[model samples]
Target: MTAPRATKTRTPKIRENLPAPQTAEGLFFHYTPEEAAQWTPFSARTLRDRIAAREIEYVFNGRDNYLTGAQILSLNERYTVKPFSKTHTRVAA
Candidate 1:
């Protein structure tokens, strides 16, 4: 008799229901790399570099690259480091 294989399941990291950016003018569906960079702590060049590294998600509309608010948020979350308490002990691998 053969044993059944085990499968692993993972939940998605990013929330799909996240809304796009809402501006004073109106809700912008997407933001250009330059605009997206302004929203985050990084620069436009950094965003481009990240795109090249496939670290962040973006859209290419033929002429330029654009990013949705959710994607930018995901990028930020991916790099966000959680701080450990001073009393917390490190686990050795």
Candidate 2:
């Protein structure tokens, strides 16, 4: 005799207004390609290149690239590592 067939449980997909865990709250909650562009003052292409180089950290799945609010702040702060002006340097003659 064949055993009884097990029934598969059906689950409904629920859509919420909540953001994903990887995303940051407040500003970077949810962002699209256009929104990502605004995160940085740089142009879109520049941002894409930076993302590819990993100079700025990002969460990427498939063709989607995501960044948190903290990440944006981090990128802004990265420019603080600039070198001093030549005049500020003491040259050894």
Candidate 3:
């Protein structure tokens, strides 16, 4: 008589509810407005304004818009710049 075969059970190791990065660059996640507000120094409204102004880059699916982590880095590059005041003006050579 042949021995009975054993059945195997598999279980997923990670939770499906956890957020995952969308891009291989690891710079983007799908975040709701509230989540973005807490993570970003800029308020949701201000972020929206910047988006409208094209000072920053973002992606929008039909339902929601998100700024990639790369976008955040880009913002840090240019957003902190202060305008040149008269006191700091350079004289023509």
Predicted candidate 2 versus true structure: per-residue lDDT over 1-93, tens digit per residue:
999998997543333464543454634554443455555666656776888888778768788776666666666678557776765767899
lDDT minimum window of 10 residues, candidate 2: 12-21
Off by over 4 Å in 2: 1-24, 27-30, 80-93
TM-score of candidate 1 versus the correct structure, residues matched by position? 0.55
Model 1: runs farther than 4 Å from truth? 1-28, 85-93
Clashes of each: 0, 0, 1
Instruction: Record all residue pairs in model 3 with backbone atoms less than 3 Å apart, i.e. clashing.
Output: 27-69
Question: Tens-digit lDDT track for model 1 on 1-93?
Answer: 898887877532333443445443214367766666655779887887988787777887888677877677777788788898688788999
For model 2 the TM-score comes to 0.49
TM-score of each: 0.55, 0.49, 0.47
Clashing pairs in 1: none
